[model samples]
Target chain A: MTADLLQQTIWLAAVLFAIGFIGLMVRRNMLFMLLSLELMLNAAALLFICGGAVWGQADGQVMFIIVLTVAGAEVAVGLGLLIQLQRRCKSLDIDRLSKMGETE
Target chain B: MSSDSLLSLLPLICISVTIMILMLQIVLVPGDRLSYWLTVIGVVATLWATFFITPLLPQQATILLTVDAEARLFSQILVICTLLLLPFCHRIPTARGSSAEYLLLLLLTLLGALVLASASHMAALVIGVELISLSLVVMIAYPFAPQYSTALETGIKYLLLSGVASAVLLFGAGLTYIGLGALEFSAISQAFTDIDLMEQGLVLSGLMMVIAAIGFKLSLAPFHLWTADLYQGAPLLSATVLATLAKAAMALALFRFYLAADLAVLQVINLGIALLAILSMLTGNLLALFQRDLRRIMAGSSIAHFGYLMVLLVAISTLHSVEGAAQSRALLAWVIYLVTYLAATLAVFSVMLHIAPASEAFHQTQLKGLCQRHPLSGWVLLLAMLSLAGIPLTAGFIGKFYIFTEAVNGTLWGLLLTLIAASAIGLFYYLKVVLMLISPAEGAEADPVTGRWLTRLPIILIALFIVFVGIYPPSLIDLLSQL
Candidate 1:
């Protein structure tokens, strides 16, 4: 990739990351929050691939693969926990999950 | 890699092979007792191997890992902690029945921690962190009792937050790679020192993001919102793992990274870490003062403890180079501080788990007349509280004293003042718990269930070590200073 193209890619990844972070903050539902997390992770992966292509090295691409694997594992465990949360709290809203302080 | 290089990785390999074997045993035989004993033996063997492999002396196992003395020391500490924690895991009341999987997850977490302690490449760093947090997510929610519904909430919260932190860390690492065109720590350091050839903005922001992500994992101030909830919500044993192994691994990794980094961006990074340290100290202690539950108090206190440790990062920045006498002193102080913190934290949690393995919240009132009823646990908790408070003639005091002197030597007057003030504030709640433990109950309180000697042995040894180290600090100082 050309220098100009790599700069543009960086900007695109930055913007994508901002969107994901905002989505994470704004969303109240557990599933959407997890999706937002995936978005953020993908943006990071994009940055790695862009860097790899521009720098002419395999390490960035290797990191990209690793990031993808990490994101996949996170989602698998996340969805499992979310299902359990859904069953126990009877809701997927993060606001409804404030049962920490009350006496059992 | 040569055979010697593979041999240097004996500690990690031992743990990994043990985890695989435990997984197979769980699948086929499916017995908790057998699995538990198997894990204990595996961890003990790993601990022995870690010590045994030290003669090899700083071998690079691959491009990914550096099995140095620091790595070996932390690996030993983590493995020993796992061994100490296994009995409590077995003792923890799991209403969900058949908790053999918890042991498996714990070992995986240990493997992650060991990887982190030795990580010399970006890939190793990310993998280690993900392994630790993901397994922790499952372990946090392992006790599926309806009464502890917050366990699920804590798990979800930790999962989402930790996920964000990992992404942030990766994004930062990606940007860093773009600026420097390398993922190895040595290359990054070399490129960073040649500042004119680097993209300063890319490297700076990328490093800041990486530090912020680590701060979240460490639960420093402004990133510490989830700590109290996690402490209160998770099972006590898992919380102990979170407090000791997880924090120690991340902190040690950060410390090693700081050691490898040159002076190009040292000023900015040091300032950021110093700010984090101050905020964590003030906020952790101040927040703990109002907490009624023991776990929540520990949450606040742990944040503060890490804050105190962060000051050493600033001390490193003050040194002219990485190989100075001052730097060695700082490293010595750090290891001693971490060891004492681990011993004291494990002691406190051991007492908590022994006291109430089934309760959701360990309230202050629950500890009424603990000394009169259960002298051994009461004394251990009291000593732990005093050690945490940094009172003289306790292990915590020794750790604090070294940190105090390092801050003075570094001329960090502002941070030193904050450390002093925070410890004072910390002393209140710590003593409050101590007083409550020692004082007689207002009404009738049942006697504590003093479990078998096996359960009490860890606490007794920890308490004895606390006093032993406190009175004779030179032995530890001499040993660690050589590192």
Candidate 2:
């Protein structure tokens, strides 16, 4: 039963990771992209934990702590920059912020 | 965490002290002037510690972080970069934020890069990368003014893209651990040996994912869309940090990982990296051909150089089966290329630091008559361009010469031809800029040199160093072969 549970968790993590990866690419909204990034990060964290559980080792969980810390840092700065972006562009679409590319 | 092991981390500890004291000062008294000098002192102390204490390093500083000779060398480069950027660090003219906070973040970023330079395990890699990148996001967006929206916009783009990059890196790392049951780099060779490459597809896929992620960070082509935007948008000093320190640390980390992993069997990996090299060379040079913005042009030039670096990387991997002077030469080629690239980049960016006005809109035409206006800086930029173009009597030429020799040794003829063509395209734009600097402008006012001696000295000294190294590269070669 525990083996089935671990397998199920791994499958779920993979699904979420795919969803996040796709959403990050497909979404035009900046906020959605940030959310997708978070989703991907948490998915990795979930995989690390389950992988550790299967191996009966603690390194996976140890890695998760670092992942969590990184996630928090990213969110803190990402949102701050998001607010700044909103103020400047007055919109959340990434398409509008494409003025930086080389102009021929 | 023993006393002896603690001794090995003195440099890290010194930087941490710098961070703590800066934080305390910010809490007790915002806009503290003393923090600037404190940050400088901290970087110097860390350099001294890295130089003096690393020789007596403990056998292990833990599984996560260990001070190896390679790490020590990269650390020396990082500290020296920080030392050179100190003159600019003192005066950060911002809209709302204080320079104190800026200095704190700068030092923190350096600390993270130092960890990356020496990280032996996966955790330190993630942590160090995150720390450096997060600080960068804030530092890019820190100087918020009503007029300058480009910085904010670019910061958001970098934040989102870099965030996704970190997640990808983490996921890849996690998958690798699942396959190998170990996260330490030392375990890579053992895993490659034990597992059948065709069957354990997870391990290979996972490693490839990690490579892709790093390529994003390093701004390799196809993943390099953000390089020009970020370089053009960030403050000159911040751009310098991104171009020089962050990329060097990532390249060194990749070098260590590539050296450790078994790559002789994997033909696909080498070809893939070579393709990226070719793409980067084409994209970087072609994009720069049309750019009127000086910052954007440098951005493109950096991309081309990264492509050149990748050729050396492929050479190293192709020659991985051997363990002799050939192997060392491959490594030496990449390091020499990296070193000369950094020096030339620093010279260019430092000149930009003085030339670009408060609004940060850098037009190529503004460089006209710079030689007549501010002869010292104009000449420095001129020399920097020559070196960057790999022209004769420049450090870049020697670096490229060594790279060409190694490419032949590895027999990467296709990449060699591509690199040669890129350098040809590279020379045109580089000369265009040089011509812009020396020639007189139509109606522009005379832009005099305004910065103090502290900043000017480094730019001139670095330009001179480029020339010196170009003339006598044997010394550097001898030193590299010793390494």
Candidate 3:
């Protein structure tokens, strides 16, 4: 029964990672990309909790807590940046970020 | 009862208190010069605390943190760099409404860096890394100038990349925990010895994942695409802090981790690092050659510098035959390199901030006639550029010489050759800046305004340190050897 639960958790993580990667690669919206990043972080935390359960150890759980903290910090900073970007460009499309290139 | 154990946490405590006080003051009192001065005092106090208390900590404090002489020394340098940045922050016309928030974030970033410097555990290390990253996001976007759209975009890039890196770090941590059932460095080292090859592979992958994330932070090749843009877009103060303090802290942490880990089983990863080093050197120097913007040029130079540092790191990983003197010498060389590199970079950035027009335009042409108008600032910048180019009679030359010497003794001849070639390419761009500063301007005279004395003082001090260290490096080397 534990094995089944573990498999299900792993599957969920895999799905989340896939979705996040697709969103990161395919989506042009910067906000969506950030959301996808959050999704990726959540998947990592889910994996950590599942791993902790399987190993019967608290290290993974402790790590999950840290991951949660990092995610929260990231969102706070990320959204602040998003607001600034929106104010400047009135849009958050990733494609418009050509200012990153050398010549630009 | 150990002095080291108690002293280890002093900087952290001082910084935390200072951050709280600064935040509270910002909330209560109106944002003004007083708040800025408070923040500067906070950073200075932290610097003193780092010097006085850090030396007392036990050489290696706990499984998660080390209070060794090396970490303390780097922490001291980082504190000084943060202090040097204060005046620049004050003088620069901040696009953001409140300079207080900028100062607050800068202090928090410093606190995070100090934590990372002493981190001996994976959890502590990750936390430190994230703390610095989160604060940097604010620093990068703090200048809300219309031209700062690029800065905002770069912040978003850093945000997303850092988030992914953290997740990768967690994933790696989870795998390592599953394999070794522990997060402590010493236990992980022990586990590597007892575990089977497959289990070892799992642990290795974990380390590599963390390294990848760190490489992004360090601006090493394949992960350095974000550096030039971010540095270019951010304010001069933000760029200097990111390039110097943040990179120094991360590099020191990585060095300690490599020392503690079972490096023997990680031969492939070390080799991969060497390859990346070469690529970064070639790419960074080559790309920097044509850059018109000063910030982009510095960004490219930083990438190349990291390449050289990585060479030293790769050598340290492989040189198991030499235990005491050789190892200590290599480590000392790296420490000295970091100190000298930070000083040179900060001095250069300080001069750039002074010369930059109030209009916030940073084009190369703006630097014209600088030598005629402000001879002192021009000379300081000239010295800084020469030092960065590793010209004779400068700190950078000595640092590179020591690193290459170590690389040669370690038999990393190929990397050493590439390093020399890259340094030559780097010289062109550094000289280009010097040329711009010295060359006569066509129409307008350079701004006659001497920058703030507080700002000018640090630039002179850093320049003096560069020359002193360049001429006589033995004392600094001796101090680093004790680490």
Candidate 4:
């Protein structure tokens, strides 16, 4: 039963990570891109949880908490920057925000 | 932990206390002058501890950090670079009302770099990286003038891309943890010595993900799309930090991790790194040739230089068993390369900032007949360019010489040839900049660059130091060997 759970968890985490990565690449909107980033982070957290369960160790759980904290910090900063970016560009498109490269 | 371990972490503790004090100052007085002096005191204390105090204490501060020689050297470099960068903060065209926050964030970023340079566990690595990148987000966008809108775009792009890279790095760590059941560097190395096939597969894939993420941070080719833009758009202060402190810390962490891991069984990963090195060297130099902007040219140069540093990674894996001396020398070579690279890069950026104090978009043409106007700036820029191009009788040549010798000893003929060719290509652009400095103005003389003596002093001193090191390579090699 534990073996089956382990196998299922691995697949689930991979699928979630892939979905997040794909979402980030596919979506050009800043908000959705941030959501995808959070999803990717959660996938990693899920893997940490699975690892802790399998190994019967707390290191994985500790790592999971760290990952969560980091994600939170990223979101706080990302969203703050997003609001400012919105005010400046009047749009949330990554392509439109990239006016730096062409000027050179 | 024991008193000795805590003492060994004096540098980190000093920086943290400084950050807290700066924060409190912000709430109370909220003046840039007070905050700036406080930060300098804090960083100087950290530097003193790194130089005098930490050396007397034990090396292992905890499982999460180790104050070994490499960490000590890197921390010193990071702190000194931070100090050099602080002066530029006052010159930023931001509103005077809230300039204290910039000093606060600078200290925070320095603390992060100190943590990263000393990281010995995966958790510490994650924290260190996140701390640096997060602080940088605010620092990059701190300039409030409406004319600097590009800073906002740069900050957001960096945030999103850095977020993805961090998640990818964590995911890789998670996978590695599942395979090895360990987070500490020593424990992971121990596990790698005796692992099953299935676990090996998991570990290899995880390692690849981590490398990719690091490569992204270091801005290696194929992952270097954002680099030139960040350099061009960032406030000059943040750009200097990004180019020097952040890259050096990440590269040091990557090296320590590489050395700690039992990499004999990871030949494929070494090969992958070699491939990235070749691509970066070729692409970075080739792209830098036609760049009109000084910052963008530097962005390209950084990509190629770090690519050359990747050769050390390959040398370690291949040279470990045959001759241990070669492996150790490779480490020495890395230090020389990094020290010279940092010195030369700082000089280049400082001169650029000195010349174009108010503007971010520094065009190459602005340098026309610099020798006639500001002889000091022209000479420093010329020498710095020579050092960067690895010309003989300059510091950069000594560094490249060491790397090339190591490459030859490790039988990395292909990488050596690539290094040679790319460096030749690099010389073209570097010399072009130098030529512009001396060549007569085509149309009209550019505005005279004006700066206080405080900035001018560092530029001259750095140029002289570069020349001194170039002429006396033995002194540096001896210093590195002693360390």
Candidate 5:
């Protein structure tokens, strides 16, 4: 809650976000990419909560909750699409999912 | 915060409640016709109510939403666009009996656009964007047909990329909040005066991240990889929504963000947007040149249009602090250009949707001697292409002319010249489509479908609007300048 703690929390969040961004780039699998996205969102939420505690305002907390809900909905819809894609292509490899283009 | 402010949010509240009630009614007694009619009625009623709600002139609906006159005008545009396209939704052939859920998702997307258009705080902006993109994901894959495998693929691509982009935007917003200690635009503008942007590296980088995310959404070049693929894959009506509602909402939101921001690093932002505009125009036109598919062609041309809009943004920026005459005049030109682009998009897509409801793509070769088979549809398309090409006596020409003048007056010589050259290249591809429709095919087999008059009606009406506006644009331009 002190200024030092707040700066550290932000530094931690920034590091976490960098890791997620790296994971998203390095991973080719669809599921891991999505999880990386979640990691990034969580980092954002951490920053919001830390900022709210420091500023003594509820707006940041409210934003965190909304981001959480959005992440859930995105995952749900994402998994549904992935499942359908898996059924057709018989694999989860990103390279294998390129059948949407004109194959002829 | 005040009761009066809450009262001013009547239109947005109406849309939210309508979505909820529609959800409840569906669970109680589900019927597609009933749901569709309910949505139609809801959107119309909200559109009507938007006008009647007497604001405190321009009141803050809450800490997040601002009920300003510009917001009202933009809300009117979005609502009217939805109402115009609802008929297309009704006509879009979905599997099985119940597409009530489709109606729900569409309404939710509208709600998102409504929220986004009025967002004055970072939290509201984040929520509004997530709402729009999430709801749009469901709608994009709504067809769920075996052959529409591309639709599902596009859905997955959109989900992942859009999620990442939103996360990026949210992270930037969080950084901004930490730097400024408040989420409201007013707070940020106030902080801009006290804080030296050169010293506040965190705030500068945060603003950059936010702009990058917006550039991704706008599909400006270098960040526009997924546009052609998504446009090619999504269903026609959904594509129309993406091209018009989603693009317009994101553009206006970015416009408002810039409007509210009193940044010291103003040149960096302008240079960034201006460079993006130039890149989009060059890259978009070059990509469209050899493409034979209609959807991809439309997608590519839209990037060029995005570039043109970006030019106007620069014009607006230079004119922002000037007396009312120039600044408002720039905004009016931008809005009229948007309206014309919407007309061209709707007119083109209506015909395409009706002609190829189930087909994946409309090839250039497929339309050989289309004029002979269906004159109404043919002329509808011809007019669309002509307008899109900014040919004389069409809405696009006047729109482009106004924007070009704004650019010259603003002394954006580099951007202005780039626009002129890109538009010349644009005319090539646009004409290819028009010529494909008009030229008689050798040994051509007559096409079978003439389409319903109901389908032809929208095309004709929109095309007529294009011609009407082209000839008498001053009235509308005058009206927009008043905003």
Candidate 6:
């Protein structure tokens, strides 16, 4: 029963990862892309918790906590930056930030 | 059990204490320079502590952290770089007002990076990485100017990317733990030997994802898009720190992690890394060629340099010869390359800060008539640029020589060729900067900016070190081999 649950969790994480990857590739809006990234992180967190439970070890759980702390810090800094970007460019289009061009 | 092991931890403790004192001082005395002095004293003390403890460190201290000679060497380099960077924060107009706050963030970042240099476990690695990243966010956005929106944007992009990378890292850690049932690097290595190929694949994937996350931090090719904007937008002092110190720490962490992993597994990742290195080299150099902004040019060049460092990584990964001498040579080459790269980069940025106007425009025009107006600064810039371009008798050339020699000795002929070609391409832009320095000003008068002793001291020291290392790299090579 526990193995079945672990397998289910892995499948769910795979699904979430696929969804996030799709959103990252398809979304033109920067905000949506960022949201997609957050989804991917959430999937990773879920995977970590499930792995810890399945393995019955504290390492995965410790890593999960570390990931959570990093995630929180990242959001704080990233959102702050986004606000500044929005103020300057007036739009959050990721595609438009190609001012530093491939050749230039 | 040994006194050496306890003594080895002094630098970390000193830095921690310094940070606490500075934090307390900031709260106690709102407008005093005590916090600044304490921070400077802290960095210097850390440097001194690194020197004193180097002899007492055990061959290999613990699972979570190592006190090996290599780690000690790198720690000292980091502390000295931090010390040199302190006074520039004072002269750099943009980093004013919150000087104490900036110093605190820098010290914290240094602490984290020092930990990263010594990290021997996945847990320590994760903690060290996040600590540095958090402090970096604050430093990047510290400039309160209205135009600092770019800094804010850069910070946000870094935050999001870093977040994704951390999650990826955690997932990798989870997979590794499941496969090996241990978080210790030594245990993981032992477990890999017993694991079947199919299980190895899963563990390899986890390692790859973790490498990708670190690749983002290092700004390697596919992961490099955020660097230019961030460098351009960040305050010059913070940008210098980011370009030199932070990247070095990330590289060191990745190097150590790879060292602990199985070579066969690492071989599987080499193809992808080679491609990334080649792409970063070509793209970085090519993009830098037409850049009008000096900061962007440095950013592009940095990407190219990272490519060179990746060449060393690829060599270290694939070379399986059991000859300890050959391995030590490779390690020595890597250390020399890092030290030379750090010095050359710091010298260039220091000169940039010296010459830059109050507005910090960093346009090519601002550098007009530099040779005529400030001969000393011009010569320093020229020497640094030449070194960066890997010219003979410069530290850059010696560093590149060692790396390429190792690559050739390891018979990575294709990678060696790529490095050579990319370096040839890189020469154009380094020359471009030099040309701009020597070119006559069209209409605008050259602005004279005199720097204080504290500001000039680091640049001069770095300049002399570059020359000394270039001419006598064997001394460093010998020191590294003893480690």
Count of clashes, each model: 0, 0, 7, 0, 0, 2
Question: Model 2, range B1-483, lDDT digits (tens) per residue?
Answer: 677787878888999998998899888876646878778788999999887875675346899877766677778888888888888776677776566888888888898898888787888888888888888887777783433556777788788889888988898888777767888887876776686654257667777778888888889898999998898887667788888888888888777667656554566777878998999999999999889998899989988998999899888877777667798888888888888999999998888876653546688887888888888888989999999999889999998898899999888899999999999999999999999998875665675556878787778778888989999999777765645
Alpha-carbon runs more than 4 Å astray in model 5: A1-7, A100-104, B54-56, B196-199, B263-265, B442-446
Model 2 spans > 4 angstroms off = A1-11, A86-104, B144-147, B196-199, B262-265
In candidate 6, what are the lDDT values of residues B1-483, reduced to their tens digit? 466786788899999999888888888876436776777788888998988986676545566888787788878878888887887766234445555777888898999899998888888888888888878877877764433435555665566667667767777776676666677776766788787785687678877788888888888888888888877877677788899889889988887787766443456678778887888888888878888888898888888888888888777666655565776677778888888888899998898876652344488776676877777778888889899999988889889898888898778888888888888888887888889889876765655557766678888888898888789877667766666
Give per-residue CA lDDT, model 4, range B4-75, as digits (tens).
778888889999999898899989887777777888789889999898764554477778998877788888
Chain B TM-score list for all models: 0.97, 0.95, 0.94, 0.97, 0.95, 0.94
Residue B329 accuracy (lDDT) in model 3: 77
Evaluated at residue B406, the lDDT of candidate 1 is 92
Runs in model 6 deviating more than 4 A are: A1-5, A20-38, A78-104, B1-6, B59-62, B91-96, B145-149, B357-360, B441-446
True-vs-predicted CA distance for residue B410, candidate 4, Å: 0.2
Best by lDDT: 1
What's the CA error at residue B204 for candidate 1, in Å?
1.1
Sort order, DockQ high to low = 1, 5, 4, 2, 3, 6
Q: Candidate 3: lDDT of B372?
A: 83
Residue A96 Cα positional deviation in candidate 2, in Å, after optimal superposition: 5.2
Q: After superposition, how far is residue B413 of candidate 3 from its true place, in Å?
A: 1.8
Q: After superposition on all CA atoms, what RMSD does each candidate show versus the true structure?
A: 1.8, 2.6, 2.8, 1.8, 2.1, 3.3
Determine the iRMS, in angstroms, of model 4: 2.0
Candidate 6 clash pair list: A78-B156, A81-B152
Please tell me which model should have the higher lDDT, number 2 or number 3.
Answer: 2
User: Which of 4 and 5 is the better model by lDDT?
Assistant: 4
Give per-residue lDDT, candidate 3, residue B201. Answer: 75
Note the chain A TM-score of all models in turn.
0.91, 0.85, 0.85, 0.90, 0.90, 0.83
Estimate the overall C-alpha local distance difference test score of candidate 4.
0.85
Model no. 2, DockQ: 0.56
